[model samples]
Target: MLKLHDYWRSSAAYRVRIALNLKGLSYESHSHDLRSNAHHDPAYKALNPQGLVPALDIGGHVLTQSSAIMEWLEETCPEPPLLPPAAADRAAVRAMAALIACDIHPLNNLRVLRELKNDWQADETQTKMWAKGWIAEGFTALETLVGQHGKGYSFGSEPTLADCYLVPQVFSAQRFGVSLDPYPNIRAVNERCDDHPAFVRAHPRHQPDADTVDSNH
Candidate 1:
């Protein structure tokens, strides 16, 4: 069985969960409370030097990084493919995924928000505005891309790697009070994903360690 080092609200971990569910692969989840700094423990550090969530223990070998793990899943389990067959289409899907994974998510993750509040002495309002600003910027660009390429999902009628990345980011955006009204395409995709079994099963709220406490970013 695969072992997944996870945090219920980590969007990176959330992405991997979506991919794993989409691939119909089962994994054992080991919850690490990011708000409590459980990820910084030496044991987890040894497992993944970066001490990030969503590390996959595939038998004896381990895989870190949500994007890498999802790519590995796509390669290992090709059925119900997360990427398109055509190279150009695949590239487009990757670009959409990167818009959320790289451009948007990195800036608004828990660590960055914490840094803003703790290191820079930003109040709650300022931190929220910081997250909202980046999300709005990214969503502005992503809305155009999704409008151009999306049918029902982020790329085509079927869910793809783009959808896997998009859904979690939407969750994060909602958490930070970023409105989805400006991006109907993005909102529509999220609405479509809401009914998807894979997406529903992989939601952060459904994770083993989910709690009512407002500890997420």
Candidate 2:
């Protein structure tokens, strides 16, 4: 059986959830409470040295990193391909994914936000602004890409790896009070993703660990 170690409100975990659901894979969910630093527990650390959520145990192998996990699922189960077959198209999708995971998310993740408060003495208002700024910047570029290269989804008429990364980022932005009205294309793609069963099941609120803190956070 497949097992996924995840936290409900984690954007990285949410990406993996969407990929797994998009592939129609069945997995058991083990929820970790970020509020309590459950990710740093010895048991989880052994599975993922980085002590992050969305670790996947599948077919006797354990995988870490949301991007790596999503790629594995795509390579192993190719029916509902998350990336286009064309090399250029694949590159474009990967670029979009990187924009969120590397450029945007790292700066605004829970750990970064907490560090800003503890180390730099940034208040809630400042942290919120930090998150909002990064998200708006990323979304601005993504919106332009969507207008130029997107179809009904991020890349084409069908959902792709880019969409998986995008949905979670949008959700995180909304949680942090970022205004998304400037990115109509991003919101349109998000609305399209919302109608898909895979995206629906992968929603943060649908996870078992979705309590008030997780949902509102």
Number of the top lDDT candidate: 1
User: Candidate 1: minimum summed lDDT over ten consecutive residues — where?
Assistant: 208-217
- List candidate 2 stretches off by more than 4 Å: 213-217
Clashing pairs in model 1, backbone N/Cα/C closer than 3 A: none
Q: What lDDT does each candidate get? A: 0.92, 0.91
Per-residue alpha-carbon lDDT of model 1 for 108-186, expressed as tens digits? Answer: 9988889989889999999989989999999999999999999999998999999999999999999888889889999
C-alpha lDDT of residue 146 in model 2: 86
In angstroms, the error of model 2 at 179 is 1.5
- 33-70: candidate 2 lDDT, tens digit per residue: 98789889998898889898889998577899999999
Highest TM-score: which candidate?
1
TM-score for each candidate, following the candidate numbering? 0.97, 0.97
- Cα error, residue 148 of model 1, in Å, equals 0.9
Model 1 clash count equals 0
